[model samples]
Target: MQYVPFTPYRRVLTLPRVRPSMALMFFARLPMTMTGVTLTLYVVSNLGHGYGAAGIVGAASTLGMALGAPLLGRSIDRYGLRPVVGVCGVTSTAFWIAVPHLSYAVLVVCALPAGFLSVPAGSLARQILAALVPAEQRRAAYSLDTILVEASFMIGPAAGIAAITSLSATVTLSGIGAIFGVTALLIFLLNPPIRNEDELAPIGSVRPPLRSWLSGRLLATLLVAAGTLFCLVGTEVATLAALRANGDVGWTGLVIVVMCAASMAGGIVHGAVKRSLPQGVLMLLLAVLVLPVGLADQPWWLLMLVLIPTNLLCAPTLAATTETVSTMAPPAVRGEAMGLQDASTRLGLALGSPVVGFAIDHSSPAWGFFAAGAGGLVLAAFGLLWTRRRRPAAVAPALAAAVRARR
Candidate 1:
């Protein structure tokens, strides 16, 4: 088949509501990407706490989000998007607005609820994309979404740091809170579809049982998704450690931008192409490529160059994972399924940081890279084994029926 590079993206963009929805979601996610770093800065700079204390609040919030995602998603499935968004929006806005006014202890206590009610923007974006874009073109849609994610990360943290460093934390945080409220209101007003028209269930239709849709294949996909995050986060921690060890900390931003650029390039190609690597294979390559990055840690630029190959797979791996989950999940429970994907990725991020940090602390940054790759390999291996084991069990009923017919 004759291939046109821009055709896939054009097709996806041409779909009804895809363009405006994606644009709104892009802006909506900016505040989300900023919140973590901004909160850490606020805790350390304003509240007179150390990084460790700041991390406590951050960890609490992460835990809350990890626990809350599936529940919020289920709520969306049952009650629909607006009600959940309304409650979460008001709660999140109230929490962020109240942050600068609270004592450190109170802040910590509030962090969990704040995170629990934080709008499920990322998952919502994927759900909307799945609803708006047809299944056949979802790879492109998700790839584009992943590219936007990369762009958001590249912009959000730096902007947050700049804002917090220049303005008072009180002002910056209040601004963030205001942004949250405004974006939430915008999302409510837009009210994007979460399920395709054809896939919409009739009134009183029961959602399929969890066991029926959450198949072994889907579980394996989630495992791979988690592994993808594990490797990426670990790589990031290792990179920072290596840079700090080599006294190249000042160049950190540049190195990160380069890494993001590589990932964006890869995402572009992945979306524009007719076919690309499977999620498992892309994730495996992502993990494997990072294993040797620490060897080039001396010159900061060299380390950045070595990091590119692994990062190049980043957006593609993420996009493929989203596409896979969207495909495997029925529309009725897709919100919950995407929520699980979010939880799994968060768990991976939660585990990656400390585990890789410990490795870098005890041994060397090189070992951190090794640990990250090894951890990813372990998850990927387990997923592979799980699918292989289920294959025979899945085939057994068919085999029995064939044997009876022959008899």
Candidate 2:
């Protein structure tokens, strides 16, 4: 809870290019943030499908995005951002435009491919932040990015739901497609400095092996990133379960917003803190907060109060994951690194509902909370141990490379 002045954040904003790009990215990411919720609603409401069918479609999309992220990142690293943006933009927009008319079977089958092209807006924004700022300024940048992201979550799903409520899911889904198109156009015009050839190896220089990028440190970070989301989303599912059990479904949305506000507050503090806690420490704190939430399910208010502390750790964990990936990845393959991070997040979220839902279904709503906490702790323990054991051996190659480079 140590506070640093906002001086760092002010300086970061003062940068000529950072502000506009961030603003655009903030809007650009909205469509992406809204998709999961909006799509689920569409399938369940508009298409006359059961929750189970909607779940499958949603899961398909998540799987596609997870599979696409790394490939897209590598393409961005190799071929640059514009081409990749163009391809995804065209394919995605076309899919959405035609999708509303398709049969349910066709829609289900297309979900995976459509998601594969879902604008990589989130990853690209992180790439911009990493490339634009120096190491010292990056924590604040990451914090700011996390805050904006929280804001997007706050707005995106609500916007989608509202659109569907007022108009139609078809119109909303199609409109989101247009948003993706606009985002692509913006990225193409802005041509942000994600892949400055000068920053990377010379054109003819040999690329480092993928093994270098997938070092023990990076792998651990990826796992922790996924685990963090696992807890967050699991808690979300658990909250829903608790509400359903109590017949308080109407409170679900407001309760989730309260949780998001807690996370936003934590992000604000995390950014303002002079030296943030290590990621491992943050994960442990998160686990501690969630562990007792199960006991608080008696009353809806109690569940909200219990979730506050656990949710507070949410954005900080995500921001730290971004910062770690930024620091760990070489400039040459930073896009790929960010992509992998995005993929890990998607994978964790895809797993969260099922894992928590099963726990709640088979046992009790209380077990969902317990399972979330236990899962987080188990993952954190794995990462911490793996990192400690490999610490010496992991740095050897980099050290040798540094020595060679200095010669």
Best by lDDT: 1
lDDT of each: 0.91, 0.86
Per-residue alpha-carbon lDDT of candidate 1 for residues 268-327, written as tens digits (9 for 90 to 100): 999988889998899889999988887888799899889989999999999999999998
Whole-model lDDT, candidate 1?
Answer: 0.91
Question: What's the lDDT for residue 399 in model 2?
Answer: 97
Cα error, candidate 1, residue 244 (Å): 0.9
lDDT of 2 at 367: 92
TM-score of predicted structure 1? 0.97
Error of 2 at 129 (Å): 0.6
Candidate 2, residue 336: Cα displacement in angstroms equals 0.7
lDDT of 2 by residue, 1-407 (tens): 65448877888899868999899899988888888788788878778998999899889888999999999998998898899989998988888777678878998899999888777988999999877877788888888898898889989999988997898767988998898898888888888888544576775877667996788878888888888888888988888999999998898888988988998889878887788998888988997789788888968888898889888888888889999998888888888899999998887788778988999999999999988888877777888888898899958887999999999
After superposition, candidate 2 runs with Cα above 4 Å error: 1-4, 195-198, 395-407
